[model samples]
Target: MSQTGTIAKKDALAAHPPAPPWAELDASCQLPVLYFLLSGLAWLLVGTLLQFEAGIRLLCPDWCAVCPAMTYGRLVPAAENALVYGFASQMGLGIGLWLLVRLGRTPLVASGLIAAGNVLWNLALTVGILAILLGDGTGHAGLEMPAYSQWMLLAAYMFVGIWGVQTWAHHTSGPYYASQWFLLGAMFWFPWLLTTAQLVVVTFPGRGVLPAITGAWFAGGIQHLWLTPLALAAIYYFIPVITGRPLRNYHLAVVAFWSLALFGGWSGPARLIGGPVPAWIVSAGIVATVLLLIPVTIVALNTGPVLGSRLGQVCENQVLRFLAVAVFCFVLVSLGNALNALRFRAAVTHLSLNEWARGFAYFHGFVALTFLGAAYHVVPRLMRRDWPAPRLVSVHFWFTIVGLALVVIPAAVDGLRQGNELNDAAVPAVKIFDQLRSVFGWRVLGLALMSAGNLAFLTNFGWLLIRCWTPGIRSAVALFIDQSGKSVTAR
Candidate 1:
């Protein structure tokens, strides 16, 4: 109780104050991440425009038939290429870089190179999308971009991704985090996947049917090795942050990561089932796809409690809601994929809208939602401001969920119907076409809703950035409601 004893106690407490919950990432890294996100969102808008055109064409094939570039074949591919390469790839890289830097507790090295890489990456995508519209598409489902543009994209990706590698290598002395493992794994896998696909399918021109096999392989790698990991990394980080608890069964997360890495890319061969390729290839893909359930189950078990504990808070937190939906969708997609890889289902789903539905579930449903959630969390920290429009954010979230549901549900049903009709010799081709007209009409409605949601997001973000530039009036014009429903400002 003496003054000297009290001073000693105070000193002890000061010496080891608990660390802040979040990382103190360097300020300079914000620009590169922001640039990447902005570019990605811009492309998302462009892709949305293309989606409207493609969707309308589905409803009326001859609506724009006079223009070669507006043909369904070209427009659909163009939309896909824009969404995958432009929006998905860029946003994935941005979120990955941000997580890597934060978790590694290091400043981003060579950030200027990353900025340049981002610009070049966007440029390459632009050229590639233009090429597709001009009928220079490679005709590969995932690799529709021309060879020249792909090479440029690869080069640009290296410039940006190397910094992530360096950050991981220089991570602070401690046990590696689960998020870091996934981010680093994605950065490392992408280049190999891209290069392998390019050489086998485009640069070297594989033998008959080989190109198809290679394309399918590359597409699977992109989903499993690249996009899935990125999404997982975000989910892993966001869940703990939102719930104010560490991830339960932390050791299982490591197993999940390794399982995904080991078994993920091999599942690509599932697409080759019933193809010209050897029977062993198809068998390998089916086995790999089925085995994927291991990791999926592990992830579900690990995150389920964390999400369950916070169910009441999910509605209040935008980031938590998005992440919750994303994780659920991820599990569903994985299960669906495994089941569809079975011989019976694959035979029915092959060359049908069901395949497109599955792709949408992965890219739009899982990956995009996770990335948006991360952006919602990260942007405020980067800009030193809160999101200016909560209402708009809510609108975006609901619209996206509804739109995706519309697309996935209807397309899947139509695919099943078409597949059964194809298997039935009694069904006339004209009747089948007529049936699909209604399916495409539903897809067009979904696309319109999605486009509206994306535009709302874009406008909100644009205003946020503009407010950042004019700090003098930010307090007056850039208002955001706090959790208690009280207005606050960046100041």
Candidate 2:
């Protein structure tokens, strides 16, 4: 061909590159994945409302005092369970399954079983939340769900997990990505944590401080081992894809991964520092929590340069912005946890709302935000449609950033104040709690903003689904109308 002809061919190819071959894989799992995402978003809204209600009650004890179910004891636990299991875990599973199939270069297997398991899991959560509200909570911090509910969750997990493992096992030949490792770890780690909590703490009824120790361990594992890993899986997978570059320091990713798995579970006991648990256990936990910084720092180092290099791209792409913020939150939360675990700091902060602030930052700011980015990238591809409202995405992002700031910063500062006051013999507990009413007000405002963000997401997703399905609905209606018209003409 002549030079002009070749040049024109190159330009045409640049204008319309070959399409990615992801359509079939995405289609195969579309229904189940969409179900998980939608239900997860619904649960997030539910949990946020409950959180807002609980915050209000804290500010004014008489606000909901008439209803037993609205008591702080019941409402707080129910909210935590709903947010953790109903929203975070369920959403993480959906995202993880997609990553597992995509990264493995394989079609989804056992999708029917996976969907059934997903339904079962949600049903179990609903029952457990109701059980807590009705005063059937076991009173174990993380295992508040009753014994039967725990068993049901475990069974539901087996149906999902067995197939996940099988899918991973049968993955097509390729070098594994870092996301796969984290996804697989999460799939296995959650069951172990839940089973142990059920057996040792709930089902078997451990003696005295053993139950407390076990509960703390279980709670910690859920955050560190299960939720954080799932978040990281998305982070690792999406960062490079969005930036159109390989992750920097790729060699060290394995070290970071293993170190996290090693220390994440052990860090749980740090929460028990001032409790009646064994001093040795507490000391071990402190060490583990501090060591967690190694992996956290490694992650920052691995991803920071690439993100820094792509500052323009990061700004232009909404998903990249979410992952960037997630990384920052992950680093900040890790450092805060390490500092809080120290004996000197833990002495004052123990039993204060400082821990609450940290939990919120980690869960909402880090993990959930990461998933938000993932949803933006994945949902559009699955439906073969772009977001119906780009502006709603921006609205969600801003609301989350501002809302998280309002919630975390004020709560953390006030928690420290409460902790310091509690340590002073001269200060009365009543005065310290009385001062917290204002802090609770700020949290309520934050929760409202966050809930608005959730609503925006839900609305955007609903619109996208409707747009995608509208053609089919219209076609079916038109066919029926045509048949009726022909019959009338014959008559």
Question: Which candidate's TM-score is highest?
Answer: 2
TM-score against native, each model: 0.91, 0.94
lDDT of 1 by residue, 402-444 (tens): 9889888998889889888888889997898688877778788
* lDDT, model 2, position 386: 76
lDDT of each: 0.83, 0.86
Q: Give me candidate 2's TM-score against the actual structure.
A: 0.94
Q: List candidate 1 segments past 4 Å from native.
A: 1-26, 472-491
Cα deviation at 24, candidate 1, in Å, is: 6.0
Clash pairs for candidate 2: none
Residue 413 miss distance in model 1 (angstroms): 1.9
